[model samples]
Target: MVTVSLPTPVQPEFDTTIHRRKTRPVPVGTVTIGGGHPVVVQSMINEDTLDVDGSVAGIRRLHEIGCEIVRVTVPSMAHAKALADIKQKLESTYQRVPLVADVHHNGMKIALEVAKHVDKVRINPGLYVFEKPDAQREGYSDQEFADIGDKIRETLEPLVVSLRDQGKSMRIGVNHGSLSERMLFTYGDTPEGMVQSALEFIKICESLDFRNLVVSMKASRVPVMLAAYRLMVKRMDELGMDYPLHLGVTEAGDGEYGRIKSTAGIATLLADGIGDTIRVSLTEAPEKEIPVCYSILQALGLRKTMVEYVACPSCGRTLFNLEDVLHEVREATKHLTGLDIAVMGCIVNGPGEMADADYGYVGKQAGYIALYRGREEIKRVPEADGVQELINLIKADGRWVDP
Candidate 1:
């Protein structure tokens, strides 16, 4: 199930070389992730799971905007029980999008009770097993480590059995910020420490013959996040395990900064063919995070879920109110997925620069604009009428679909 492969070949439209690491396929509800499935785009709800109505609304909104998977936090038994009602509500109305339960602190306990309700249960390896930092213990001896493994097996077997029986999957998610005190004391908060933390739990599941699993390594810092995933892959190979990876950059700020920061961290691993499911963690409305997830996947040629935009950087030679017109063009064309549209500031390089676009809008003179069908200049129109003219041009070419 774990095979190293050449990058999946792309059609001529995209120039890319990213062969995803081949792992066993894990089904989360109806969606298939990893094992050559198109990189899945998912988002986590900010709403608490116990607030069923609010969480359901968030999940519905995300699904409407092309989010393939939605996750909710389950911090207590009440939260775990509420997932059943939430699942039923969404299934009864909205499409039965795959739902995930993100359980921290005593996740095994939460996961056990919620196994029958959600598609997948995500447990942070860092917080799953907590030993007080001050507990008196030296470097674990072989006998002590063996006893610990047996204890883990005894604790995890019931949950593992329940998940396998219910046809649910598990994500052994690891976070840099919450590495266990044992891990911190032993490995000093390094990537190795993170991987070891996940492997501790993963080995238990494998021992119990459970196979539906996903893994994640997340950090706010890009370098640390990227290094952790790369090292994770190397270790998985050595152990001959093939669990799919969920990629993310935790607490990636908000607005443009979040988008850029997430893009750098997620895309770096994706370009190397290392991620299967990804969430762009922005400090904004959860629905707003969906577009960035798809955009990152689109840019990597892993998947295309929205419009392709080409906007030239404005300069001294630019004409017209570039800001107002650019916004207009976007408002008109944002729904045009797979069609490349160019909005340029001036003729100095607009026509040549937009050669890849199917259609373009370029500044000609003050209060005037030039349009293009690729590189050829098509027509001239007044600046005030340019937005409408460009829409008309695209519609005439049969490239426009009513949004």
Candidate 2:
């Protein structure tokens, strides 16, 4: 069997001072949501927002799993009422995790009612329309369109003013499939159209003198999402508005495909220092999105307090059940935050391969292993206790402290 040499690590371009975008900081409760604070990893709760117990339970679970901010969809008056109770419970229990109320249709009313309870409000631009296109094609025209815009403005005005007076923040979320018909008609259905829609909202907020805000220009299509945000950034720069940007690809499917698509859109913007916060919208449970968001941020070196696991794809040169062992160890240590562990099949170059790791295990003589920190061999252990022993070492090393 032919052996493949491990790939060499390319040295990163060195910079003494990391350049960060200069932005106006926006506070979401106790946590500063934007402006050079670490990129916030946010997730929406899947529980019915009207179910206070269920929503609170979901929020608590997400908090325990390291989700920083939790959003819940408030679809009606019942959900709006639950928001106050949920916020009170969360504040008493998980004091640090802020709750955002996701408002779409009737956002103005929901935003007004829930403003006092939730930390933030997410307004999706598409929900302002009262009639579907099919209904519109039969008869609706200028009057209906004008009424919709006027009603949207009227609905939004009080909440926007109240939030500003109370110093609360809001996120104006614009999705690709949900662009305002007015914007689509004026700019055409493209990135430029999306950017213009976002600008319209920004202008609205600015006119209301509401400076505490965040903006999102999301598209299910990655390229469109990227282009819209890029154009929005340029416009923000030209207009001198420094509102923090919330990044994501909306409706990014499920499983591996979702993760990849969200990562591609988020990473592209983050690498260039464009995004301020992110949410990876997936078809999966909201809880599942948290870890993926953290992973993306960790991989980008934006987040450091998570276990970094590296394992080899076993081959003919491997000894023992490498795949099974590694899989078990990975799953077992999914909650082992802030530790860097490596599991390798062979010692030939394994030690050299994982020099950046805090601790690692490599295969040796039958039922034996080499334990290491960097290139130094720390100990030899039986296969049965190898994973346990590594965990103990990491705990003792003070690399994985509880937050």
Candidate 3:
């Protein structure tokens, strides 16, 4: 029989990396969003803006713990003017942190003032040039719609020009609960309305040669938020607009479910490679949100800020207390960054499953554990000596550092 050497069987290559959507870079102080930079973490400080010292402390607290950008509410002219003091104190007492001011409800003048003090100014499209709804009116006529559009352009131009001339950025943050009556009537209470509202403001900004903009479409409900953002991406792509998107799930309540809800929306978009900056809007302290943000990014393999622990659940084959051992390994290595360590319960799957880890502690025989350095069994030691030996092995490899 002629040996048929069927063209050597080839395994298909699969890429496991997240390919983020391409977008233009927008600067917020020292940090840059999009243009292939690392995804940013941000949050809002609930301290009253007029309380200069408290606001400064709040901002410093968040920034010290990896909050890349911090936002404050500018609800009145006093709050708007107070930002100057806030910015000054932050620079003198701490470093100058990137600041964003949230302006709402006919905030043309307020936005222009806050634009001077903050690195970025965020405006709600529906409320920036607010108009009271007519209780008995029918749908807006074509001319009526155009007239309102003109009013929006007239109101939005000054702030856009100020930010453009100063080289500052703007975020067109549209909330589901705050949609304008015009948008609600024209496009209904839906994601399409949110996308359209953003597009209208974007066009005005574009007309003035101002493109340093970030956009957010946020809702309390996950499905509505997801749909708005996905639709926004589609519309932007079709229109050749490449502004970076800021992601969040607004008003997610406190505790376990809050984190889950925020993660469900934020991580889903991030995994799809859509978001540039993110804020987890939980009802807890702003400090509490930063950890959740980093966890999501780390879990996706986007950023490695802490040690990665890979452990197998204990079963009949397990020789030792897997949970306790894993906890010990983690406590010992938690301070070390950029390392992946594995704690396996049995030899049957330990070596094979942990082949990708930097180091592993595996259950071997009765009262013994095998230490591995990336698939190579370095040594076998008593179960009691396993943790320290793993540390010794890491030291030998020059990967250990004092905590």
Candidate 4:
């Protein structure tokens, strides 16, 4: 008889402290937001609402550049109709990318109309009420303010319920410029006020049993934006509601300054594993936002398997045109994925620094380059063919090369 042996149970490998916050998953079409899914990056198309063709064209452009979610403003009934047609075309062409309708007010009517078309709705709760500072200054009573708040809540109630019944997702996007005057007065015009405003809306959604929701508290000021999100996270934890947080610094300027501001604020939250989606709002074309968002996520290690280029800054000891070489390599390999390449000025520290990269090229004597893969010298290539040689090696490894 053969001896029988019992199998030993497998043991846990290692202990890690990096636990992602538990969140309720909300789906916008096929893309799942929150609940441990990879954080999504989204952008809004800045096309005229009346120009349906232009808007559709913009959507196509955004899709080509990897915008997972696109938001277009539906301000009027005509815009809503345009959205319906646009949605039909988008569904047929780009089925995977989801469209979100941005509705400011008239929630009851707009929500009912747009709910049939778009995958998600972004409501600015602040825009629900029409604030008249002069009227309030005329000795408005506390009861009147309370009544206004109640009315605003009542307006949103049926709309929220209708959308929930229709099984659509909603985002309560609160902006600093549009806060209710009453809340600003109650909590003061500070970061705490922003948090309170967001919480109030979130509680309203929860009261309606609409848990498939995302929340954003955006302020143009960096300090205000940072403080508000930190406070909002604490408040959400206290409430025991795990809705996914959408992170962005709203109206973050146009060029390098805007990129820096957005990256700084978003990087802080992502490093702490707090945000579930990111939007790098810039004043430039919406297509530009996609790459910036990806770059931010890539730098944070939240995104795995992308071509990462590390080039050293040229110093006095540099032997060649390191700047020009680095630029050429970066531009040529911008779209390649799942590889790490480095361009260094010198072989002494260059090869050693890029020891873990899949392939690298270090500058040596005039018009010569030292190619490497994980500290081992692969071959020598001319300076002109250095980048091409690296590309060929990467392709030989069966990684996709962008044409």
Number of the predicted model whose TM-score against the real structure is largest: 3
Per-residue C-alpha lDDT of model 3 across residues 1-403, encoded as one tens digit per residue: 8997778878888788998999999999999999989999999999999999999999999999899999999999999999999999999999989999999988889988999999999999989989898999778999999999999999999999999999999999999999999999999999999999999999999999999999999999999999999999999999999999999999999999999999999999999999999999988899999999999999998889899889998899999999999999988888888998999999999999998999999998989999999989989999999999989999998989999
Per-residue accuracy of model 4 over 1-403 as CA lDDT, tens digit each: 9998888989988743335567889988778889999889899999985787788889889878778888888887778778877877766765546889888765567766777788888888777555655654544368976687678788778768877887889888888878877777777788787787777777778889888799898889888888888888898889898899889999999899999999988888887778888999999999999999999988877785358987777787676788888888877877777678888898667977898787788987778888887678888889888888887776777874566
TM-score of 2: 0.83
Please, what are the lDDT tens digits per residue for candidate 1 over residues 1-403? Answer: 8999889887677645798899889999999988899998899888888888988999999989888999988889899999989989888877688998887775677778788788888888767655556667666666765676676677678888998888789998899999877677678889999999889999889877898999999999999999999999999999898899999999999999999999999999989889999999999998889888888888877776666778876778889767777888899888887788888898777878789888889988888888888888889999888989999998898889999
- Name the lDDT value of residue 81 in candidate 1: 94
Segments of candidate 2 deviating more than 4 angstroms: 1-20, 92-97, 129-155, 331-334, 364-367, 381-385, 388-392, 395-403
lDDT of each: 0.86, 0.80, 0.95, 0.81
Q: Judged by lDDT against the true structure, how good is candidate 4?
A: 0.81
Clashes of each: 1, 0, 0, 0
Candidate 3 residue-wise lDDT at 264: 97
Residue 358 alpha-carbon offset, candidate 3, angstroms: 0.7
Q: Rank the candidates by TM-score, best first.
A: 3, 4, 1, 2
Ranking by lDDT: 3, 1, 4, 2
lDDT of 4 at 250: 95
Better of 1 and 3 by TM-score: 3
Q: Score candidate 2 by lDDT.
A: 0.80
Q: Estimate each model's TM-score.
A: 0.89, 0.83, 0.96, 0.90
